[model samples]
Target: MAAPLFLLAPPRSYTSLINAMLGQHPQAFGLPELCLFNVPLLKDLWIRASDEMSNEAKTRQGILRAVAEIYGGEQTAATVKMAQHWCAARQELSTGLVYQEIVERLHPLVAVEKSPSYTISLERMQAIRAAFPDARYLHLIRHPVGQCKSVMALNEGAFALYVNAIEFLEDRAIIEPQIAWHDLNINILNFLAEVPPELQMRVRGEDIMENPREHLAAICRWAGLRDDDEAVEDMMHPERSPFACFGPINALFGNDPNFLSGPTFRPHKVKFPSLTKPVPWRDDNQGLKPEVLALAHEFGYQ
Candidate 1:
């Protein structure tokens, strides 16, 4: 079995679109946000890991959609129901083992997946490495300003709150998405320190969006896959992937809802905001934290 390729990044970092595009490769299979490693046992997925968050049901949808598509050859209400049964049968198994089974089922075709939730904790990432030590990792990054703004735009920064990325001031605490952006990237960096250099890579989301063909080809070459025109052309149409669209009613989401609504890829230049500018989401006209700026510089952002 070909070891899977994992994309590591925080939420709203172009992961959904990029994962779908990579999956569109003929030799690769793009999976929705399996989020399997977020818990130890398969059954733990059904249990809310935190009282602060209540989106456990959505996280399980990816595995269900994947099982439905891979086993039943389609994603429908009936197949998703069957997937529920599949999970129940192996609820006691380690999530690592469960993920390996899925990878084995797609042998010879590289399994590509990314779940932003995985970066919330280093332990979840460690579990992934334990499961597939030989797996390749792509650490996808976005500009702090852009990423934090996008986070705040979605559900009023729910993800930041879920991760406890809050900043306490003189009298009150405010949702600070930049903290999440910085901390998550720090988590990814610390984790990647343990991975062999040859098995890992880093890329900016803006670079990919601005020049997908070039970046995608480079990624393909790194993974030992064909980087020919034909392969690159196929990757251009991420919407063609089966998981690109909404699944059955029983399992409606396994990825970012925005990506599912419009999986089409359009090449365009990405605008980068000034790191020192007062953030739009802030009421106090505060810019990025010093640590956040330091990390942004490390990521090659001005």
Candidate 2:
């Protein structure tokens, strides 16, 4: 069985689109956000990870969708039910072993997966490394301003709060999403430090959005896959991926709802917001913090 390739990024960082695009490759199988690593055991997924957000139900959706498509031969409601039974039968298994079963089932085709939730905790990421030591990782990044803005736009930065990314002032505390953005990237960087250079890569999300053909080809080459015109052509339609759409009612999302609503890849330049401007989500009319700006600058943003 081939080790899977994981795309690492915080939520709202274009992970869904990119994962589908890469999965659309003829030689690859793209998976829904199988948040397997979010918990150490299979049963933990059914337990609520936090009270800050109601994100627990969908945690199993990705894995169910994957199992239905890979084993049950379709993603219909009945098949999704079957996937649930499949999980129940193996409730005592380790998450790593269960994940490996999916990977092995899709042998000869590289599995491409992304679960932004995986970056919420270092232990979650470490779980992945332990499962597949040779797994390749693509540390996909977005501009801090753009990423943080998108995070706030989605459910009012619930993701940041879900991970306790709060900034405390002398009198009060505010949900500071940049803390999650910076800290998640740092988690990935620190984890990758021990991984062989050839097994890890970093790509700017905007770079891939604007000119995917070039970046996609480079990624395919790095993964030892075909980079011919036919391969590149296949990647242009992420909407064609099997897991690119909302699944049955029982398994509606293994990805961002905003993205699953429309998974198509339309090439265009993503406008970058000015770093010095006040963040729209802030009622205080305040700009980014100095620490946040410093981190953004390190990411090559002016």
Candidate 3:
């Protein structure tokens, strides 16, 4: 079985677009947010792990779509049902085993996936390393301001709240997305410390948006994949990916909804925001925390 490639990044960090783009490589298969590692066993996916978040069902959608497409050759209502049955058969197995089964099915084609949810905890990522020790990791990053702003824009910062990215004042608590951003990136960094240096690579999301072909080609070369004109061109069109759009209604989301609606990639320069400026989402007019600024500097962001 081919060692799969995993994209490690916080939510709203351009992971969806980049994962789809990398999957478009002829030698790679892009999968939806197979959030399998978020739990221990396949059955745990069905069980609600948190009362704070109500979207447990959404996390399973990726595997359903993946299984439906891989086994049935399409994602449809009937196929999703088939996927459910497939999971039912393996409910007793470890999530790593289940993920390996899917990767085995995609033999020769590198399985590429990014489940932002996985970044919420270091243990989930460690599970991936335990499963595929030879796996390649791409540490995708975005400017703190850009990522925090995008986080707040989506569902009123629900993900931040889910991760306990909160700040308590004298009276009330407010969602603090920058905390999630800093901590998730920290989780990724700590996990990568155990991975062999050669098996990991880091890329700025804004740099990729600025010049996809150049960055994609670099990634292809590092992954021992074809980086020729044809392969590079194919990677530029993330929209061409099967999972780029909404799957069957039953398994509707395996990715960010915004990306699902507009998977098309247009080449443009990404404008980064100032790190010292008062964040737009905070009414108190405070900027990023010192730790966030320090981490952002480590990621080459000003």
Candidate 2's TM-score reads 0.95
**Per-residue lDDT tens digits of candidate 1, residues 1-302?**
89999999999999999999899898999999999999999999986644313488889999999999999999999999999999999999999999999999999999999999999989999999999999999999999999998999889999999999998999999999999999999999999999999999999999999999999999999999999999999999999999988888878899998889999999999989999889999999889999999999999999
Worst 10 residues of 3 by lDDT: 45-54
Off by over 4 Å in 2: 49-54
- The lDDT of each candidate is 0.94, 0.89, 0.94
Any idea what lDDT model 3 has? 0.94
Clashing pairs in 2: none
> Number of backbone collisions per candidate, in order?
0, 0, 0
lDDT accuracy of residue 242 in candidate 3: 93
